[model samples]
Target: ASAFYPAALGQTTLEQWHDLFASNAQAPFFLSQHLAPLLKANQGCIINIIDALAEQANPDFIPYSMAKTALRTLTTALAKALAPEVRVNGISPGAMLWPDGEHQLTEQQKQKILQQIPLQRVGTEWDIARTLYFLVEEAPYITGQDIAVDGGRSLNSVQLHAP
Candidate 1:
């Protein structure tokens, strides 16, 4: 499932937070559970689209990060539960799209984020798409995995002091 309900902590209401978890985490779990019979019958797989922030602490986006983190966990757990018949996996994308509307970043802000990526650039949708394709069509033995489609952003070193 490729859908997200994002919300910041302070700016978000409790209901929004609930919805974020519901859409990002709970929906996938329930949908997969309900569709398991069909998928197992057809020997199909499930791919959950998560975010790179799922593995890291993002205080600015606490709800979103938490929801995706739950999704990551669900991916692993579901894989183990529905194995040997229907595989379940996830893809965590990073910087695949610029924030729109009020969340848009300045040019300098965008450049700063790009500088953190080891590849020194943002990733393309094709990068994520190809990974999804690989997990769905090519990798038969792989399951219960969340592959990061980041441009090495997740590997950025922790710097106590800047050079």
Candidate 2:
């Protein structure tokens, strides 16, 4: 369970920051900790879904970016903490789904985002699912690494923030 809200530093409330941390960082850590024994016993893997933007600090989404950075850290930390049995990895995705409701982008903004991707399109949920499938089934020697499935969006640093 993840929550994202577009808010700059001054615009963000403490509660919202905490909520982002809880959703993005704390939940994954505790859940992975609790599931580690079982995963180790079964020789299973842990795949965390991260955001491609986690690598860069977006002023428009300060807390969201921070929390996701923490998740990225936690993913690697857990990989070392649970090594030799349970392989831990992460998938950093970009622009898979358009924001709805209050965060919904205008048509122009959506087009702006599409232009940033080298593939020039948004990704389908199936893209993520297929990556997940690969990490679970095909990837055996891979661990403690994050795979970017962003259609090359991360290759560019331009960001679109709600106005």
Cα lDDT listed for each candidate: 0.86, 0.90
* Candidate 1 lDDT over residue span 21-132, tens digit each: 8889989989999999999999899999989988778777788888899999999998989888999999999887787888788999999998989898888889988999
The 10-residue segment with the lowest total lDDT in model 2: 152-161
For 6-102, candidate 2 gives per-residue lDDT tens digits of 8797899988988988999999999998998999999999999889879877899888898899999998998899989989999999998887888
lDDT of 1 at 10: 67
Reference-based TM-score of each model: 0.89, 0.92
- Candidate 1 — which residues are off by over 4 angstroms? 1-6, 157-163
What's the lDDT for candidate 2?
Answer: 0.90
- Residue 34 in model 2: shift from native, Å? 1.2
